[model samples]
Target: MAYPTLRDWLFSVKTFAAAMLALYIGLAFELPRPYWAMATVYIVSNPFVGATRSKALYRALGTALGAAAAVLLVPPFVESPYLFSVIVALWTGTLLYLAVSDRTARSYVFMLAAYTMPIIALPSVMNPAGVFDLAISRTEEITLGIVCASIVGSSLFPSRLAPTIIERTDAWFRDAAFYATETLSGRIAGSAISGARQRLASTINGLELLLSQLAYDHTRPDVLARAHELRGRMQLLLPIMSSLADPLIALYNSGRQSWPEGLEALLADVIKWFNEPLPAVSEGYHPDASADALRERIAAMRPPAAALASWDGALLSNALWRMKQVVDVWQDCRSLRIIITREEGSWRPHFRHWRLGGTQRFYDRGIMLFATVSAGLAVVLACSLWISSGWNDGASAVTLAAVACCFFAALDEPAPMVFRFFLATGISVLVAGVYLFAVLPHVHDFPMLVILFAAPFILVGTLIPRPQFNMATVLVAVNTATFISIQDAYDANFLTFMNANLAGLAGLLYAYLWTRVTRPFGAELAASRLLRSSWADVALTASTLPIEDPRNLAARMLDRLMQLIPRLAATDDHRHPSIESFRDLRIGFNALDLRRLTGKLGGEAPAAIAHVLDGVRTYYESCVNRRKREPVPESLMRSIDAAVARVISQGLANAAAPTATSPTSARQLRDALHALIGLRLSLFPATLTSPTPPEPETAA
Candidate 1:
């Protein structure tokens, strides 16, 4: 048997209570006929409909404004059904446009107006005199519903947004620490590091979103300011985190004897400082005496200890340099403790890729709008058909509106959700109608109805917090309850509701299938392109250098390599076949990092290689700072070309086994070698150049 989570229990109790309250209001007041429609106002008032409070408020306001507009216009235009339809269509279109264009406060206002047209206007066509009364009644019911839902939602197992923000912040910090440790250990190579960086960026973006949601809750400004300060500190930590790969790889390859003395102790201190509460004094004191002792032990071993006896002096120096950077990061963290504590102000909008702009955004918006309008139309058609017939005691207009709200609100993902909405709406309508017509006629007690409604709500609510099938099941109960409660009595409309729902399900299924067919191969192609691009960059960076440059070109190259790390991580799918290829690309980048460090220290004769490495590092550093994949420097490219030519020339002349070989064979060998070098060069052009056609081997 599956266990119920905290969310499940909360949702069950709240939903049941809301349903009971709606019933009481309808029964006690002896409201006019179409009690089902009034009850729908309560159902549509769910907070989840809008996700955020502001959006929900906007949606409510839109509903009210649109309802009022419908009442005012219906008296004059209700006689002409065609005119009313046109007015509703125009209003809906305008509202949708506002929703799309104005993402802030005004967006929801427009959307509410757009959606109100069919619900309020279409129902008043038969009895124009009743339009004003119906609109007023709906406004009252909806307002009451919103108040009740909000009160219950807030009091009953409310998940406070602030705590979520703090948790995400802590998670991001943990991931960052893990990434740093892995980079230093040499366990994560080039592409993997890139992937890690990408993950870090995404986590940061999520944190930003959380902070934004929290900020909207009318919290104190001081708390919000503190969150902002903490976020700034984290942002400052990004570059330092990216730069640790070089020292880490150097330490990993230095052999045991070449390892920095007390390096492990320093690492432990860094982790402790990050994980533990801040020390009282930021600068020269340690809260834990043992941590101080460890630092002292490491400092004593620093210049030369047992660990360094067999190691080269240069490697030791590089290790110390990297360790000092880590120490500096810890010191910054300690100083920013206050900022981290003030968890309120960190909220900001999420970072969306500017590259995802232009046509793609427009298309997504269009799909959402189409889904919403179609859903509204479906609801209106169902209600109109039911009313036109003499079956007056069946489902009401309000019931249809409630269904529309739930279905259309989920237009965020139109394809998959369309069918789910249809199924939910159809089933709810049938169950409610059947209970009223066949079951309710025999049972006169309110207690039975409460129990009957409670059973389904409890079952669905309890199942809703699970990971996979929660949504589908919860919708079933919610839609059913809404349908049952609103209508005064159920008359037979089972087949009509079922067929309409089936049509909705079909629309959603078609959209889902169509999207898959149109977007096939995007993931694999994206991964391949990213992999090839990163590889070409690594190769080009490795081949170039500026002679006599003092800046450690290896460090620069490592920085360049870090830029690709995130891209590689983003392209990963645990099940993809090309994952192995991605792994190879990562290893190749790490190898380049290693080669760069060795070249810098070995001080070999090809001074041009050193200069090119420096240029590569510079370009990489620039790219990181700007958060973009910039062109490789021209100076670096020319130097790489010259070095490749020189290497090829030397290899040809120094062919050791000068056997009696055919001239054609020699020519072919020379051409192949040159082509290989040229291909590498073409991979990392310093400008906007078309990608070279892949050779058969690379393509394979």
Candidate 2:
């Protein structure tokens, strides 16, 4: 093998060495094994699973407290298995409940308290007099394991999460820029606009997760500050983007179809605007005449072709102006070169704020809790079954397997991860067994043992940052060291280590196979259901007739489409792939179209309602391909705007028609107008397609 490849191979298994050395020290010196398991579990699980530093602290604290509590309780009820089981179950339930009820860092404490009780307390019943000694020994082992794991993880091959966050954020900004430009241009419909809006929201969600990690870890202040600033700028952009939708749509719906020669030049100017330094506001440069003249020409444009052309011109002008402003602000901020504040008091971090009703639709909380509990139970059950079978080493073997499984399972939601855990453990056992039996007897010196132990950890730790090989090497080293330390070749310890390691491997395989069989269908089903529901919503809104109450309906449709678009993007099934893709495309188109109509109605209840209904019919026909793609070739978007303008003009004329009409007739007309406005607002809450039905009725 090449020298670099061989060096890399050795470096990747460094953590495994640390784990092995810690376990060997504890077991070889007759220290307790459970403490090592506790420490190893915490360190390995935290970094492997992407937990924040605060969470790791909570977990450590909880484990320590639970272990202490278990030491106190286990002895008093040792003779009665039934009482012990009940106490364990009740204690676990209480901790789990507390974890569920709380939303802050304290929740991790509750989770730890519940599970720690079992690991520490149950083992003491085997020998009451030796309980304290065992507990102390276990604590020592755990501390050593934690220290080793942390050193290996942080120093050897640390994975810095900040770069990933930056990359994702950049992608979000690019997508947002495209979305804003498209909305201003009025080249897409309301549904497409809504889809873009939804994508923006999703990107925000991802950013929040990254920030949470940084906060929990107490990362550099400058990084957090930059992230916060970016978030603020993005928030400001949303409202401005929303405001431009109507004007662009109106211009598109008017008669002008082609961009004017000067307007085309302006569009090119805006596209290259992001890189340019912001223009300084000079004195007496009133340059207002040119803009006024352009507006007049836009107003004089006729139907169809005129609407499209005028909209193109307006969008280009407005976007160019806004782009200049944004670029200026960006340059100013960059030039200040201000370091992000690291002090806690510098800014009130809003990362943890959960708005009212935000949690209603996020059902993953329950599933996460359930999975944790299930893992604990699976371990306990394995131990019980093995002990009942009267196999002398069965109980210990099961316990070892259970602990190993628990460590890995805690980090990942899906079952496949457990396989990695088992593989690591099994390989460690085989390698350690071979080393202890075949190589150890030949090297009696303490220096040789130290070299043997240190070499693996340093090598594996160094390579742990690599994505593919790090975990496997770390796991192998950990399991091997742990097994060799606990087991003595001349005694029963050797056989016990082998059996326990094998059991752990078996448990992992079972979990992996079971999950694959059960949850394989979830993603596909979610995609199909969301698509059907989105289509149904479109049809229902279109059917509402008299076309005067669409604002509320349009809002509702937009909400539903937001939830569905992501799911469609994630699915990989090739069955009816085009159908799903087209459905998503149509939904995107419709959302943008609806938003344009909303803008034209300008809060005129009856007119806005009528325009939405018309838009919905067109949206639906486009979905089914019933209306040819070119049906609105003359830019009917402009006609819809004109119709809206006419309705508003007529309503004003009627309101000024004076007391020529009866009081009852006037009252009825006013009530009808009021009802129309209410109906338009009501459309905003329509049910959106979701991977799962949301518990809340409204979209965030």
Candidate 3:
């Protein structure tokens, strides 16, 4: 006995009111295409006031830019249709590329920039002089729709993104806790961990979107401030968690060095601490002191600087430091969970501070470049075919083709979706005809018009939130508005309506054909490419200058890893995926670790480290190529030995000289060497572990 929720009813009514008002304004102004205003209402109305406002603003701006582009570009090349089409195609391609690359709501601007040119300019190709008026009408109608949607959505039982943000934030940490538990256990299978990683990445991306949605919400200053703080804290969780894994993996692989004393006890205590209930934000979390005490005890056992050259000492010391980091992150997570949950409202004083850096994502330039070409080709082919046919309704085909290409630009498999769009267009045409002929013709007044449209608008608006139903509903709403064309004086012409509808369907068909012919890569292949590319980047990171900003590169690589994990987990053999995925990630972390430590080295150490890095790249390149595994060559092993010796000796010399500006960080240097060694062994199991430590003179 479930009933219609308040949210659904209010959202439906707001959508209906916005559409009716926009239609009234459009009819009053006598815009050339009043249907556009009506259609824009459904397109922009969202459940949240902030989301609605944000989307409407961006949509309005994008529409204006796109309209202006069509006006300026179409008239100049009108004399040459092919030249004009090509120019328009180039503009569409460039904008589409930008739209696909951006991951935020701002991308709506680029999407509009890509398709609006075709919608406006292509229809006026036969009469270039009319382009200006067409652009103005398009802009004015869209603006009217945007204004109506924003006003109605904000005023009547308006929703706030703060609540949605909080909901998502809660879900994010729940998944994060599950992921953290697995990672800290140190005995979990790769497949399980990889899947958890995928969820974490998704949560991070979700949180990011919620953070952006904050700009639109104005409900609670306390909640807003807490959310900002939570997002910054969330950023540190991934890197810190990633850092902890290296030590666990190193300990697992080291058969010669005995486990560091009290290590297992510490791990058990941390796991127990993590298992405790997360405190509510209002509860003011006080971290358990046992975890901190364990970490301090571990730190007090650090080996003397001279003892670091011992392989066992290096392994133990590094493990302890990573354990300390694990504790810090554990404490941080518990504290943040409370902060994010606490609703301080206006009572929370906002502190002005430099926010902690968040994870950065990389956009693959090469893929974007290729996408630009494909988009341009899609437009050129569709437009050229329409022009050559000289069909009276060519505008519909040209416009739909560009719309399909621009709208579905984000999908890896665009052809199937294009076909769906084609089917949806056909269905929209059918319902649109029923409404236009049977109901709209009888409507004599605006009040009657509202009644006629009420059911369709409310039902469709309710379904808009559903992922599967959204596309079809939107198409129906749009086509109904366009086809009915309810004006003061009715013009009932069947052939004109049929021609327009068929042209719309034909446009989708053109897009479908173009995509099928191109044979774009599907999700699996794209994901595979992403994994291979990440490996290449890892190898480059290992070999090249450590000066480059690695966070963005790492974030992108992790992003790809996140996407790849589910696909790999779905395959038959989960063990191999676990091994390979975690293996590569472990290697990447080690490379980053070494790169950071190398900055501390002096004398011949820099040159020696460079030699080791070159060799390290060669080992990973083999993994990237999926070639037969090889031993770390004797020469490369010798180079690593020399580099380690140089760093250890330089640190001892620095300690001996009291006047030195800086003493070499012996523990960190040893940790770096240990990470490189661990990476070497992980890459090549066939090679026997070096039996003894390199002597001081031989290393020199």
Candidate 4:
């Protein structure tokens, strides 16, 4: 355990102050459950000002919405507790689905609303006539806490989120750079490359979450724009670099001893450039001119149209072209970084290949539905037991169950997390018991209360910022505060306290058991689902006509890849086929390229390309049906080769009649050749064993 730094201490202090302020305000108003106000502070307080403010806003909105729901829901079904319990369970499940679907901080709203209704409504069931007042009081206390947290967090030594975002972005760039150089230099392959890529993808996924919260960070418009633009470019870089690995591996695997003339020099130069440190943030600086110089070298190395007829030339062309794209994206990333850091620059957005208007992500409705439904069932079972036993404090159990379920619904396996919550709640009960019976009895003054609370709250507050301990610390701090039920006058009823706190423990125990039974499989299940989803996506991309926007398709596929990469690391399930996500991504891109170029390629070429698409679609469909990995059939290879030969023949003819071939036609032919070659390389890298040495025309 690393010692708490100054920043962590500051966060702890600010959060504790916010909680006390909220408590004082709640006492001044004499609202029931004023400690709820204090609990809410720890629930939403983030180290960063913007995150705290954003959570405050969302928590308030969700609280009001839930309180209103309880008011509307409780009175009508108050006499029918069983029906009411069912309704509440359904509401929790349905909303939990929405919460888990969104993989961002914004998901907090739905999650809060999911459990908040139960928290408010379940307690009000015993006193139906006072439901409205109860709802109002709950909302008022929570809102009071939210207001205090937002004010204290933002006003006192606010930590800006932009610098953190910049730091994360720089770290992402470094990992990507390392992966790129390693792949380019032929130092890593197989599992090594897979591990490295997984780590990179994981970081990119994290950066996406941080970027989603950027708007709440008080970030300048230009920097925000640059950040979004850079995100798209960074996503594009994955495929570009990933695709580059294929042809490099193919070149080496084809019994080749060395790179084509100038190709080795070019690869070394590009690697060197990727490793070069970015210039310090300064005014009026630009990176494009330097990027252009390297791009020019790449352009010079491209094989002529006549040379593309051979497999070696096509592979060489694809490799060099992808390298150029990598350079372009890297340069743009650097430019965006400089501007984001300096917060001032004349640099315009340079990378526009992908026009991702807004973030597009992948969601698995099946898994989400299963997870949420299980949570709802848990709530129903808990409520049934509570109603049958006539336990008034059982409302706490049901409410905690719902809250715990919603909190962890997004995890692949939430049982262990729920178990931790169970343990944390147990700890909180013990601590709150000591404070209630032993310590708070002598605390007759508010200042004394503050001093007594300081020891535990401040200590737990530091742990809240660390990821591993975040959930448990937040629970302990928030639960302990509410469990003590601190008010204007110290009211410690031993029976009421034990019943309530124990019911909470029981609720968490139910949640853990239910989650364990429901989600027995861990990351392996999620990983399998993601891989199957990729195969389905590949099949759809291949078969679709008027092909989807390449940028949009790329974004969705890349997003899915990033999500899958981490799960792959976590699970040891070898049930998955010997397929690389990058290979799948490359295949998808190649299919889209061929679909787009079908119109541009006149003659027999379009028909041959269509055949390849049909074969790709069929193969993936079979994989989906058989529920196993299928080998790349030789027929698909024939189709791809036939398509390539036709495209090359057509292109050579066009070149023969220079006046008849427009620049656009020439470019289209080159694109078709590159896509076909990339497709073949991705599918059958090992089969192409013949090392046809590069000819002079294509070598340099």
- RMSD after Cα superposition, model 1: 13.6
State the local distance difference test value for candidate 2: 0.47
lDDT (C-alpha) at residue 349 in model 2: 26
What would the per-residue lDDT of candidate 2 be over residues 261-369, giving only the tens digit for each residue?
Answer: 4544443344344333222323222222333343344334322212212324323333333333333333322222122221222232222211111222222344445
Model 2: CA > 4 A from native: 1-30, 34-56, 76-115, 128-133, 144-210, 213-361, 369-384, 392-413, 454-459, 468-471, 486-493, 513-700
Error of 4 at 430 (Å): 0.5
Structural similarity to truth (TM-score) of each candidate: 0.56, 0.57, 0.85, 0.95
- Candidate 3 per-residue lDDT, tens place, 1-700, comes to 2344667777878888988899888888887778889899888877888878878888988898999999898878888888888998899999988887877778888898789888999988878899999999889999999999999888888888777776766666666676667766664445555566656656666676556667787746665655656665554465556556555655555562477666667667666776667765556446457666866777787766677667666556656665676666556555555655554322222221112232566565666666667778888877788788989898888889889888887776788988988887787788878878887777788898888788877877777756577787777777678767766577879999999878888888988988777746767666666666767776877877543566666656666665555455433242365346555666776676677677776577778777787887887687679843344577776776677677667666766774773434645565666665555444543332333464556777
Which is the leading candidate under TM-score? 4
| Runs with alpha carbons beyond 4 Å of true place in candidate 3 | 1-5, 190-192, 219-243, 249-261, 284-294, 297-314, 333-337, 340-360, 544-586, 602-608, 620-664, 681-700
lDDT of 4: 0.82
Residue 242 in candidate 1, Cα distance off native in Å: 3.4
How many residue pairs clash (N, CA or C atoms closer than 3 angstroms) in each of the candidate models, in the order given? 23, 56, 1, 0
Candidate 2 TM-score over all chains jointly: 0.57
Worst 10 residues of 3 by lDDT: 346-355
What's the lDDT for all of these models? 0.48, 0.47, 0.71, 0.82
lDDT of 4 by residue, 1-700 (tens): 8999899999999999999999998998899889999999999999988788788888988888878889999989988989999999999998888888877778778888899999989998878888899889999999999999988988999998888887777788788878888889764455655566677777777876677677788998878888877777777787788678778766666545545678877888888888888887654675567678888888898888887876667888888888887887888888888878888876655455533453568887899899999999999999999999999899999999999889888899999999999999999999999999999989888988999899889999999999999999999999899889987887789988988888999999989999988899898888888888888878877895554466666668778887887786522222223236668878887887787788877878888889889999899888888876688898887777778778888788888999987999888888888888888877776644553332322211
